[model samples]
Target: MMIYLTLFLEFFKIGLFAIGGGLAAIPFIQELSKNYGWITQEQILDMIAVSESTPGPIGVNAATFAGNTTAGIFGGIIATIGVIAPSIIIILIIAHYFAKFSETSIVKSAFSGIRPAVTGLIATVGFEVARTTLLNMEKYNKATNNLLSILDIKAIILFCAIIYLLNKYKKHPILYLVAAAFVGVIFKY
Candidate 1:
């Protein structure tokens, strides 16, 4: 009822605004902490980890995860519908307009202008994802709020090793993800 509607609207907004993809949506979902009180940053990270490890689009996975977090399976369904609605609507609208304006110079110029805007959006999303994953120290610092040095060293070495292994081997991405998780656990970092 109300819950589903809210879920739909919120996720619809998320889908509409989070242009770059699921990873880009992370920051906005983080902002949900300010109002929803439903999920936390650590949970968001865990959701991302699980989503990346699973099938389908990352954005879809995230919506499912967030929905499940809010109200179990029902919530998940509502959220997923919300996430997809905007794309569906936009595609339909664009299809109609594109057919009508396919040959217009004004339409061509508008598209040319939109291309750069989309590029900028995508680039910004990439930067934000990098900032979250790469810029932060590996773990929380107890006293100074800085990253724990040992944890960081482990992450750096692991990152390099994973990169090298990826370049050397053409294994499935899932294998790399599994290997990274295993290495993280065995190394206890």
Candidate 2:
């Protein structure tokens, strides 16, 4: 179907550009979420969760998952392959040239320059994800109704506590995620 082809191509582009990791794919995925009604912002957050918990690279997992969600099992397969294809091909090309130019100063300098740019891109993606998840003005709209004020307070307190606890023990990411999920289920009325 045309839909599957589009999914594969878009996700392939996402995979190509997301140089850092799954988090780096957030900005692209958010754009995809907007471009296609195939998913939502909440689903993007959920995709991040699934990607982190999965066995392989988070980007690959996310591509396949989104593909499956959009089309079907074959969509998942195609998207995963499409996304990784460029990386595999590039690596092969690089590997072939690397041996010939492994000691070239210009290539080494180029890599050094690229490393920081990649890190910056990943950091920017993190900020966008955080803004999408937390720092939005619409959250304040919940204060308009007397019944909504309670929800607002709960959301703020739980968010603060989760952030504090996660920061205090940054080593245990899974624990923090579990705690956050518990807070969501218990506090979100």
Instruction: List CA RMSD, all candidates.
Output: 6.4, 7.5
Could you tell me the lDDT of residue 123 within candidate 1? Answer: 100
**Mind giving the per-residue lDDT tens digits that candidate 1 earns over 9-99?**
8889889999966787777678775678778888998988999978789999998998899889999999999999999999999999899
Best by TM-score: 1
After TM-score superposition, what is the CA distance of residue 96 in candidate 2 from its true location, in Å? 0.9
Q: Model 2, range 1-189, lDDT digits (tens) per residue?
A: 898788878877977888866678778878988888887888778888998876688888888888888788998898898888878889999999998886899988988999999899999988776655654446455546544533345555767887787788676777777777877788672
Segments of candidate 1 deviating more than 4 angstroms = 104-189
- Displacement of residue 121 (Cα, Å) in model 2 is 15
By lDDT, the best candidate is 1
